[model samples]
Target: MGRILAIDYGTKRTGIAVTDELQIIASGLATVPTAELMDFLKDYTQKEKVERIVVGEPKRHSNEASESEKYIQVFLKALEKQLPDIPVERVDERFTSKMAFQTMIDSGLKKKQRRNKALIDEISATIILQSYLSRG
Candidate 1:
């Protein structure tokens, strides 16, 4: 069976997470530059046999689409076109960043490690994927 993948898309960087082949465990995969996300996904999917993609949907306090939604939408379209066989869904990403930070502290990461934005992004992606699995 193929694994499910999740993406926490950002303007400058994107965090990636993937589930185990049985789709039981979600783990952070990588933090790549946004400009290189498509290439990264292509290469990753070729090797990982991803069945679906869960992208974080940026939302505001009022439950409206956040500004980042524009970029995500564009990327989503291209992703769909490039990989029409794999389905994609967007899950609410309201407080994943804050949660990621708290998770770092909870994990006993040192101050310097917690300060790594790339690490936070990766953790956030894992959180996003976990949220989708729990909800589904």
Candidate 2:
């Protein structure tokens, strides 16, 4: 089976992750500028056989879509248009950032390293992908 990819889309930056060919483990890929995401994905997919994509879906406490949904919708549409064959799925992303932070702390990262937003983003994407893998 081809590998699965995950995206944590943000306004300024997007975090990326991918699963092993067996889909057993999720690994952090990179954090890229939002504007560069499409090109990055296109190139990455050209080199790696990606079968599906999982995107983090942020929701409010009331179970409604978050304000970021609009941007995410646009991103998803673009992805669909560019990669029509690959299926895209949305997974709940509640507390992913918090979990990332806790992971950094547990790993004994320095305070400065823990505050690195880009690292956190990548870690968050990993968590999101891992959660999906666990479910499957």
Candidate 3:
């Protein structure tokens, strides 16, 4: 089976993650500039076999769609237009950044390292992928 890819979309940067070809383990792939995300995904998908994509849907504390949803919706439409063959799914992304921070602490990353927002984005993407995997 092809890999399952995950995206943690952000305004400035986007986090990417992918499951193994066997679809067992999810791992962080990369953090790319939001403007270049489409090109990056097009290139990566050409190099790798991706069966599906999971995008994190931001939600507020009251479960309403967050302000960021507008951006994500635009990205989603572009993504679908670009990669029409691959199916896309959305997962609620609440507290993922906080969880990613905690994971960095648990992983023993130093203070300076933990301060890298790119790394946090990557970790959050991994968490999103793991969440998708666990649901199945």
2 or 3: which has the higher lDDT? 3
**Order of all candidates by TM-score, from best down to worst?**
3, 2, 1
Clashes of 3: 0
Question: In model 2, which runs have C-alpha deviations exceeding 4 angstroms?
Answer: none
Model 1 residue 107 distance off true place after TM-score fit, in angstroms: 0.9
Top candidate (lDDT): 3
The C-alpha RMSD in Å for every predicted model, in order, reads 0.7, 0.6, 0.5
Model 2 over residues 19-121: C-alpha lDDT tens digits?
9999998999999999999999999999999999999999988989999999999999999999999999999998899999999999999999998998999
TM-score of each: 0.97, 0.98, 0.99
lDDT at 129 for candidate 3?
Answer: 93
lDDT of each: 0.95, 0.95, 0.96
Give me the overall lDDT of model 1. Answer: 0.95
Q: Give the alpha carbon lDDT tens digit for every residue of 1-136 in model 3.
A: 9999999999999999999999999999999999999999999999999999999999999999999999999999999999999999999889899999999999899999999999999999999999999999
- Indicate whether candidate 1 or candidate 2 has the larger TM-score: 2
Q: How far is candidate 1 from the true structure (C-alpha RMSD, Å)?
A: 0.7
